[model samples]
Target: MAAYPENNRTWQIIHNARKGGYAVGGFCVYNAEGVLAVIKAAERCRSPAMIQFFPWTLHFHGPAFIKYAAEVARAASVPISIHLDHCLKPSDADLALECAFDSIMVDGSMYDEEGNIKYVKSVVDRAKDKGITVEAELGRMEGGEDGLPTIDLESVFTDPDMAADFVKKTGVHFLAPSFGNVHGPYPAGGAEKHWRLDRLEKIHAALGDATPLVLHGTHPLSDEMIRVGMARGMVKVNQNRNVRNGYHEYIAENCTKVELTTLQVEAVEAYSKGVERLMVEVFDSAGKA
Candidate 1:
């Protein structure tokens, strides 16, 4: 059984943050260090945080790892939820459910509008039976994460009217719309175009505040952009590359001098600091728990 009932702790955390005009960080974890980092950061900062896994990460690490994540969430002082991020198929969602995820993102955005709605609704129906919260994507996100191919921006930008319809039709707990955000890191110089807050505002207007919005591709966005998105009803922001960057940078910087065991410890510490910085400084979820 899940430690916290599905849609109970996770939903309350997100809904409360949305109502309070703050955003929770959905930090993607691929290993024990990643999971420990997120949980420790949340506990230290007193923030409501989420530890998420991509389908590929789950494939690499296996379902048993999820139990460890669940155990950590159950033992944590602050609110934390384990979520499956960007599941492309219903079977993927089912696998996550089996692993006892509190929330799942059923991403059928590669399909046509009708097909996307149909697929997401099917997953939503199943998740609802388990009392699990479902988050579905309506707009395709550009840039690839976990070996997915990159998509063009023009083809994937979400339509406000369609977003409203999709939310009502699928009954998802949250919606991730493509409003000028992409997965993966921005170029070294930064993205030429800024996050289209105006477009996000339009979607907020169409969907109203009842439907909480989720923003993916959060790695390279500025603090101001994040604050603007949260103010416009974005309740969850997924950040992975930045955390990975921090981990890799730490290893690269310290690997030569440190013992192998100490190196691993340093990596976790660095990654935790990176994630904590986002939780406290960037996302503003610190102390919100």
Candidate 2:
């Protein structure tokens, strides 16, 4: 295993990437096998990357796994940071921070604007005390548990002025503003339905260049859209569902010929290669880390 990123190492990388007009990869990992693959890929590429675990992963695998994976990654000399992704509540985020995660993203954009600000400020205050980075959401992500009962797409777009105000009040290190970006895969050559570049530019204009902007649900976009996002103040790109599916497909294709240990080993290898490929090809994050 490679060494873990130093404390504050991940945020610094993210900050620098923003300055350089590139997005750093924030690959999601749900288990030890996934962690190994993400770290190995980033190490081989000589890139700084983030490994994130959803709160539900802890329910299935328990918190010990998260700690163990983080410890192993830290030991490796690679600039790898562990983050708790899409924490559903403040308590879950508090637990992750206490567990020594370098960062936690609070997804409270589902609330009313005022409620969202209050929730973010509370989390930011708690995380900053530990020197942990906090990422707050501005616009609600539709069709997810992160949102309220409303499923209307009309409620989805972010208000640039409101987003900037939320940041100013909360003092979060990064912001994930919904600019028409959605969670699932898109149709073939789809009209890039989600992620309005103009909206992103407006938000950037409002928030200014110092803030690191993260584009969630980044997988469904075309290469052109991704490049446009990078050019417009997006510093971190999250790729969870795409990479997981890629790894599973690789495993299914090659599993029939392998023994148990070999199958597990091959799956890890394939997953690691897939991640490296995403870093180099899809995300254009190679050498930016």
Clashing residue pair totals per candidate (backbone < 3 A): 0, 9
Off by over 4 Å in 1: 1-7, 185-194
Native-structure RMSD, model 1: 2.7
Per-residue CA lDDT of candidate 2, range 20-61, in tens?
Answer: 656688887776779988888888887778888888766778
Q: CA lDDT of each candidate?
A: 0.82, 0.76
Worst 10 residues of 1 by lDDT: 1-10
Best by lDDT: 1
Worst ten in a row by lDDT for model 2: 142-151
Write the residue-wise lDDT of candidate 1 on 131-164 in tens digits.
6888888887777787566776453778999999
TM per prediction: 0.91, 0.89
Q: Model 2, which residues run further than 4 Å from truth?
A: 1-7, 145-150, 187-191
Model 2 gets an lDDT of 0.76
